[model samples]
Target: MDIIQLLEVLKPAKDVVTVQIASQKDPLTPWFDLAKAVLPAAATAFVAWRAMNRSHRQFEITSTRQAAEFDKNLAQQTKALRVQTQIATEIEIKKEECRNVRDTCAQYLSLALESNRYKNDFDLASEYILKGNTQFIEKRNVAHENYLESSRKTLSARMLLMTYLNPETSPSFFESIKNVDTSLVSSAPNFGGVVGKCLAECRMYIEKKQAEISTIATE
Candidate 1:
């Protein structure tokens, strides 16, 4: 038979049958199935890890900030303490100077009295008076700057001049500085009523400074 006639003869008897495919897909391949099963869990684990890492970083930052603040506070306290200590040391030094000045001034007063005893030798009296005055001025400077400069305890030049001539002769010195006459009160250098009174004031000043220093230390 001819090829066209043979093809025509191979056709179905009644009609050609048609096949229809369903909408849904079949099961996936092995690798795709494994990904489908594990991807969600892996994604969840990744997200949780990221959250934990973020929290850890935040904690580290907070701890670092707290540590820095603590250091700053400690440094401030240390500086304040050092300043208080320096102030206390300075006050103590001033107290010592005050004591020295008091002793030296008492000695100068006694020396002046001794100089006045030489009534016959004018040159000797003048020499001793000049020496005592110079020594007293030198010793009184520091205490005067601190205590007497603002008060009536300061010695005037005129008063010092009279005191240089005679230790207990100056009315201003006797009235303002020391009340009683040293010779009449006592012959000893530091035992006179005036010396005692001045020393009391010095002690009072020292005590006041000590109280202030203590207050600073405590605060």
Candidate 2:
């Protein structure tokens, strides 16, 4: 071939090579720019997702702690209420016991007064018997002696009543005496009816008071 013909063929080949290189470089330039632009956005999205997940976990933990605290407070309040109820029940029981003691004392006092009256009657009966048998001066002496004995018995009964009913004094000894005297008076023949009635009434009062105490104690 001639030089000009060879030159024309080489020129077309060189131009084709240049056009391919430029096309590849054009696509690569845009791809590098896109990667550079998206890198920061992708990193930011990752960081935001991690932060949101951490916040969610923190909130869950806080909620759990709050729930636990609430349960503890509820338990404490329930315990307090139970303690208060127990204390109140004890107070009521003590109050009932005091009332029972008072009523029992009153009953004993009533019995003592009744016994004094009966003793007075017995003294008068004795005087009548003695005076009916005696001459004039003897009858007067017997009546006077009987009156003195009756007065003495009445005073004794008064003193005994005071000992039982006084709040300043302890009623323990009187309580023991109450059962013994009630039994003794009940067994007596002539005075049994009057004494038995008084004993029965006193017993009834005691039983009622005991029932009240039991009811309070149960609470």
Candidate 3:
């Protein structure tokens, strides 16, 4: 080939290189920089959205747990209130039972007091047996002793009536008051006698049962 033909071919190849360099460096550079900025902003927005979504889910879970806890506490409190109401009702019933027993004991005491009317008569007649005098008074003393003995017998008989009401006293009794059940003797028993003790102990036992019931219910 001639030199002109070779020069022409070389010149065209150099123009293609300049055009490629201009394409790589000039027109797309601004677009690539804009893409870099937009991509980072989009990544930051997506990360923020995900963090907010996670936090919202955590809040929903926390709210559900709190609601469940509230329901459980409310149920326990209601159960305790119901048990307390039941115990209060039972206590009132037991107290009413104690009142009934007390009334029964009062009736028996009234009857015993009414039947002890012979005490005044025996008090006056017994002085004659302890005095000394002439033959006339001595004869009167024998009459007085007989009268006293009759009065004593009458008093003993009156007290024996308690056995009729209470079959527990069907056994022997001592006129000296040492062998009879204390219910027959008004001079010794504390509240009233065995009858009174029976009532009091029964009420006490019921009260003890009430305390036990309260403890068990709370547990």
Candidate 4:
């Protein structure tokens, strides 16, 4: 009951203590502690990275939209400026055309007046031919040539005016000019009145055309 009994009781308590020490010093214990310390920090870092990436994407999308809008506005402004320039250029061309037409009309009236001056000489020359006067033949020929040349110049100037004006729009003006030309031969009592009427009509038409050009420019 003395030494053997004491050894058996001591051996049971020693075995329990040895088992507890072996469990505490297990090979996987250090790995488990390291995982506990690092896992939460790694998870937080991943979440922050994902949030930053989403924010970057949103910023890029906003920037792209703004750039597209700016380009669209710029294109519209450029188109408007181009249209204005075209309108200005067209108005200048129309004004030049009006000036040419007015000049041609003046030339036509001048030629018609010159032709009227020759009408009396032509009538006299015809009388001499009827009377069979050979000495007056050369004088009659010269008067006839002058009349024909004046008439040709008047017609040419009228044709040049027609190139710039639409006949359908200014029928009265053209008709008045025609009446003046006819009066050159007939030597009508209303010759001066017809010339005056022609000038009035021409001036009216020119004013109308200029007004239209002004309207276009304002628009």
Q: Pick the candidate with the highest TM-score.
A: 4
Pairs of residues at least 3 apart in sequence or in different chains that clash in candidate 3: none
lDDT values for all models: 0.53, 0.59, 0.53, 0.83
Taking all chains together, each candidate's TM-score versus the true structure is 0.42, 0.45, 0.41, 0.68
Question: How close to the true structure is residue 172 of candidate 2, measured as C-alpha lDDT?
Answer: 42
Q: Report clash pairs, candidate 4.
A: none
Provide the global lDDT of candidate 1 against the true structure.
Answer: 0.53
Model 3 stretches astray by more than 4 angstroms: 1-31, 107-219
Pick the winner on lDDT between candidates 1 and 2: 2
After TM-score superposition, the amount by which residue 40's alpha carbon in candidate 2 deviates from its true location, in angstroms, is: 3.3
Best by lDDT: 4
* Tens-place lDDT digits, model 4, residues 84-194: 889988888878877887898889888888877676677788898889987778877888899899989988987887777666988898788778878876888777788
lDDT score, residue 72, model 3?
Answer: 100
Which residue runs does candidate 2 get wrong by more than 4 Å?
1-39, 115-119, 122-219
* Order of candidate numbers by lDDT, starting with the best: 4, 2, 1, 3
lDDT of 1 by residue, 57-117 (tens): 9999999999999999999999989897887787687566555545555554454343333
Candidate 1 residue 98 Cα shift, in angstroms, is: 2.3
